[model samples]
Target: MSSYAAVLRTPHACRAFAVGLLGRLSYGVVPLALVLAVKEGSGSYAVAGSVMALFGVSGVLLSPVRAGLVDRYGPRRALVPMAGGYAALLVVIAGVCLRGGASGVELCVLAGAAGTCTPPLGPTMRALWSELLPDRRMLETAYSLDGVCEELLFVGGPLLVGALVQYAHPATAIALGAALVLAGTVGMTGSPAVRGMGGGEQAERDGARGAWGAPWRPALVAAGVGVGLGGVDLLVIAFADGQGRPSVVPWLLAALSVGSTVGGLVNGAVRWGGSARGRLAPLAAGLAGALALAGFVPDPYLMAVALALAGLFVAPALTTAYLYADELATPGTRTRAGAWVNTAVNAGSSGSSAAVGLVLGQLPLALCFVLAGVPALGSALAVRASRGARAGVPRPESVTRVDPREPRSTAGR
Candidate 1:
């Protein structure tokens, strides 16, 4: 905890971390909020799903480009316009939805635009850590803390959305989410800490490589990890539904998040013996064990405990994945690496969510845990097959010396 404290004791890192969190919460909440609004208005999950799907697809299409822009330009130049513009669009869409007579086609178009304009904040913030802290050990802790904050968002975002939807309105929730994201974006972009992080000559040269470089293979492996983690979330949801204890779901999920947060901090503090690449498989496999045990838990309480244990390895594994990515990525393309991580992980989550949704009605609910574990283990194999087993870079004193004033490089093509 002292190590974690030392990493965040500075004011700039605090601002970035704090505002980054607000933006992340908004991002996590919006999909479900949109679905709830659409479903309540349209009276059909299929149409609601379609609208959200369109939104997601549009975001996916633009993520790489936006990430590239941040790498080329600075975060302020790339993110401010995008975040502000996106918030305004969300406001317009919220008003339209609140007014109650918008056509599905119009809503879909708005959703698509919303997705396309969604600022690539996830990548930008993740990249900021590299430039801000620079020290390898401190960098590990920063990533760990960031990952834990994301877990917190997953836990809290839905609850906030649920409350908003239940009490005021989905439009209120949407507006609030937009406001939070925009505020966070503004705060982060305005911070000089994040703005001057573009690098010098070596970074530019490294960032000049094509997008299809070696970093992507490991990014895909990270995606598989996302699928597994996402599957766990979906399976837990299914398990709650199966047991007719829907409210218990939050407690179970909270336990999972808490465990991950604790484990991630511990992982960060320790000076682990091996390279991140070497540790990746074992950590993932350990998650697989806990997830597999979740398959047979008889009741929700036991399952909650199972989930907590399962979560223990998640952050460490993901931190290692990110560390591996940082090592493999070109100098100027850290933001793009972050973008790849975001895209890959979300892709996995989306896939697993859809898969678990389809199978919940057909198979025994317990088996969903097993099904989810398969991907966690598979991610390990993916890592190996992708030659992600290459050793991690040695920690160097030079890592502490990155200058934030250099112009960052780009590799869009």
Candidate 2:
């Protein structure tokens, strides 16, 4: 708790964090809202799902490129136009949905455009945190807080949209989503702290190899985690629906969220003994084991307990990945580096949904759960093997010394 308090006490930290979360909330709200809106307009669940798939694919594939723009030009210049275009497209989507009789093709085009232009707020805010808190330990705490809050936002955003749709049209939720992102982006980018970052400051620090080199390890781990998580999501739905206890699904998911939130906060507060890089394999293993165990649970209530165990590893793993990415990043490449990990997780999750669905019908559910755990288990072995292969090579220092102009601390790393 003191660590979180220290993080909030940093100058301009609260404002930047607050506004970044605000903008990111749009991500949670828009997906559900847009799905409902498209379904209402097209009168076809198939059309809604296809449009969302296109939107998600476009957003996930192009994330690194957008992050690069922010790195080259700075957040202010890159994010402003991106947010404006995204919000405008969302509004257009809302209008088309509300007008009635809109074609599926038009909605797909608008949704794809909006996704392409979605500002990389999550990455940028994380980069800003690195700049604001040079102390590696403090930075870990900050990332934990960020990850936990993001989890909550996704959970809460749907409830908010659900309430809004009960009274207002589904299109209105999309419009509100547009407004949230626009407002959040404007306020966040205007901060002095964010304005001080990027602008090609250290763009060439790593030469032609680019910022993609060292952080690939963490990105791979993140993707594995994503794969496991995606499988869990689809499997949970199947589990609940198969048992004819649909009402239990939300409780199961909520339990996962609660475990993640507690685990993240604890991970940050404690001063762990080893380097974060060294801890990655064990964390992956923990998640893998928990997931494998989840399949054997006889009922939804017991499965929720197993899921809570798995969720305990979720935030800690991601927070470590982000922290490692930040460590490997140079001044100009921070956002891009983080974005790679960000993209990998999303890509893996998105792809896993389709892959898992095919296996679900043919295989026993227990075996399916074991298969879902394979990715994280593979990640654990990969990280360990890589560490063994590079035993003689010196690892990067855990502590980062910030410029005197920014916040600096000589506390424990």
- The number of the candidate with the highest TM-score is 2
Cα lDDT tens digits for candidate 1, 1-413: 88789778744778778887888788878888888777766667777878899999889756877787777777877788888878888888788778876678778888899999888877787778877665677878888888888877877888889877768778777888799889999888877677566445544565675553336545666676677777776687777887888898779988888888888989988877656677887788788888889989889989988988977888888887787777766657777777776787778878888788788768876677777777768878777666434343455633434444554333221
Per-residue error (Å), model 1, residue 255 = 2.3
Q: What ranges in model 1 sit over 4 Å off? A: 40-44, 199-207, 212-214, 237-247, 361-367, 385-394, 397-413
What is the C-alpha lDDT profile of model 2 across 284-385, one tens digit per residue? 888889989998998988999999999999999999888777766666677887888899889878777889999997998888888887888898789778
TM-scores, each model vs. reference? 0.89, 0.93
Q: Candidate 1, after superposition: displacement of residue 16 in Å?
A: 2.3
Angstrom error at residue 229, model 2: 0.9
